[model samples]
Target chain A: MKYGYYPGCSLEYTAKPYDLSCREVFKALQIELEEIEDWNCCGATMYMSQDTLTAYSVSARNLSIAEHQGCGEVCAPCSSCYTILRKTNRYVKWDPHARAMINDALSAADLSYTGGLEVRHPLDILVNTIGLNRIVDRCVRSLEGYRIAPYYGCQIVRPVYHFDDMDNPTTMDRLFKALGAEVVEDYPGKVRCCGGMLMMTFEDVALDLNADLLEGAVTRGANCIATVCPMCQMNLESYQPQINAKRHSNYRVPIVYFTQLLGLALGIEPKKLGLDDLLRPLPKLAPAKPMEGVK
Target chain B: MGISQSVSPPLESELRSAFWDHVQMIPDGHKVKTCLQCGTCSGACPVSHAMDITPRGIVALFRAGMIEDILKSRTIWICASCYSCTVRCPAGIRVTDTLYALKRLAMEKKIYPDKFPVYALSKAFTRNIRKYGRNFELGLGFHYFLKTKPSKLMSNAKFGMGMMKRGRLATRPHKIKNLWEVRAIIERAEKIGGGK
Candidate 1:
């Protein structure tokens, strides 16, 4: 299936690997990702804070562009952009006052909002479109001996009206398990904020909470942490050292995208998985030989 | 609608105005005015039992002009940013985002310390993600405990060792080959936020 793809600012910049891995995985799964022509930032954190109506207009402008391009869905890799855009669509559908204000703003950009189109997170496409049964059937390098901790972060499940189930989410788990990975489960301060841009605004507090969540996941026996949000991925991966330097300790855990792990199970090469591009190096996993000749 | 008239306390008057000040700064900021005081959010909150005041209760406090109590309560910090109320709100007030708005104000006001164990850990988690493209759990976990001087837990070394035996902890880190690139990315991100 083909999708209109919006990688957002972080993916275009800080989280390029998320964008790269997304293309690689979707290609392997036979999904065509047509990049939206002349796409700009979704106004992720700033517009939302300064002006709600304008935020809706800008986000809707992007969505309307995809619809104008005739794409049925706009698949976003960044959770911030996904949440903002989805929430904007949701708000405009019910509140006529908000709808009118945002539409008037959009008219300035030569755009309009008609909210039937779906705004999907790439994770949703990975689970819902690739279809778990197909994911299971395609598995080659099973994660049987490895322990994985799937972290949803806040934006993905939150504003729950826009995304999936807030509590007791199982989509990520089902995908991981299908790849032959042992799923590590627990209360992970789940649905907790990774402090988003707060990492920049309040560095100390953000790092502190990072330690709490990462430490708890490690103590719980997760060999690795997997996530779907680029902002969360970038935040948690970048901050571990300051945390270590402050205490004069060195703790290293590899944060990665689920697509990387799935790519491995699908027998894609490691370099293609962007494994070496990680902030932290991963431990040796006693690499499994891939199955020869799968259609 | 049936209504009863009573003396509107002065305490309520001051508090309500302040809450509106908070409301005005946010996107979809005025949803506070539409709050119906239903308790669905409090009911759905996973940690509501642990909160000094529940999510819906905070709205009641704001509406009643008792926001000083909100400023003082540990309830703001207790939020995981789960968005339970944001999803469930009849008015859709952006509950999680709004709490964060309060969090910024609370921090500036010194309403609470930044010393919560969870706070330290989360900060480190985000910092590391920025440094590397991903997380290195080994460095992150031990790094946090060392900084906090939660060394009192050192007596529990046997427990740590036992877990190590079970292959829970990796003594050796899996260093990514593109360390320079990782360093560059962190540098750029830092520049974007400006001196964090």
Candidate 2:
């Protein structure tokens, strides 16, 4: 299956491993990811705070490019990018003024966004489109014994509610199980915010939020916290040390991209999936027997 | 700490029509004006304690025509935009977007809390996006630190070096190939009072 990919800014920087593993996993799954040419920033959460029209216009520019490339479905690895892209798509369709303003902006570059493009998260593509059965069929090295906490963060299932439950999403949980990993079914931080750009803006607030999320996973005895959002991984993983220092608690929960875990289950080398690039050291996992007759 | 209550409430004629006009401009902002003020937004907010006024109080301030007070306070700038308030609002008020509207208004009025690094970073981020068509992390960090928080720069030097060593942080901007197209869109949107 062919899809247009918008890696967003984080994929090129702080969340590069997510981009790397995402591409590798998709390639192994036989999905073609043709990148949208000349895509700009998705305006994230901050941009919209300043101007909705500009935010919508910028996000729509990406959609227009995806549509221009003749791709019906465009997927983003960053939850913020996916959320903003889809939010802009919906906004322009209803808000006439926003639509006109965006159209005016688009026309300057000879681009027009009719708002029909389907913006999806990589998790949505894997769980909904590719189907869990197909993912399980390709798992060669079962992640059987690893207990993983599935963290959806806030954006992916929220506001849009396209393919998963908004309050408590299970796409990542189910996907982890399919890959032969033990899913932490009641992971509380699943729908909580990872403090997002607040980490950069308001350090104390973001750190506090991160502490709660990390503590929730660690307390639940998760081997590692698996997430689909780059920001979540960055906040949860990078800030663990500071959070521990601040809260006077010792926790070493590794935050990994779900795609990276999927790559491992597919028998792809850990290095190839950028596993070593994580800020936190990968938690050692106990080897488990592959389920009999699985392959 | 009680900044919201310190200001003398505006007279009826002092109520700016522009505040309501701005609210009506966006669908979400319009919804916020219809808030029930049930305090769900305030309660749902994780960072409300850090704000000068709670989310529900901010909405109440808007409804009561306290634009000047809202602009002067740091509540809008302190919002994490987590959408927690937006998701939990029983009135289906897009509380988060309303907060965004308030931020936009604050930026336009140049009334954000002084010496707030978050506002500085937001400005730097936009400036980077405007110039490069994409965010230049190092450029943004430099711009932010240089402008608002130079003291924190030395502290972050090690982390910056680490990111640089790992090749995660780019030394230069990664401008899109068709940056002029992006520039055009930005300019056009700015002209329409959207990218102010």
- Best model per lDDT: 2
Over A177-261, each residue of candidate 2 has an lDDT whose tens digit, in order, gives 7677788898888888888877777888889999998888888878899988888887887777778889999988888999998
Please provide, for model 2 over B83-102, each residue's C-alpha lDDT reduced to its tens digit, 9 standing for 90 to 100. Answer: 87777888888877777767
DockQ of each: 0.08, 0.67
Q: What TM-score does chain A reach in every model?
A: 0.92, 0.95
Provide C-alpha RMSD values for all models, in order. Answer: 10.9, 2.1
Among all windows of ten consecutive residues in candidate 1 chain A, which has the lowest summed lDDT?
A46-55
Best by DockQ: 2
Error of 1 at A90 (Å): 1.4
Estimate, for each residue in B1-196, the C-alpha lDDT of model 1 and write its tens digit: 1112342577445445544564554558777678888888887665566667888887776665555567566566666555667777877777766765555444334444335443455456545533543344456656766766556247335544643553433555443344343344334322332211
Using all chains and alpha carbons, the TM-scores for the candidates as numbered come to: 0.68, 0.94
Q: What is candidate 1's CAPRI-style docking category based on DockQ?
A: incorrect
Local distance difference test, candidate 2: 0.80
Instruction: Write candidate 1's Cα lDDT for A238-273 as tens digits.
Output: 677777876565658788887788877877676776
| Candidate 1 chain B worst ten-residue window by lDDT | B187-196
Docking class of 2: medium
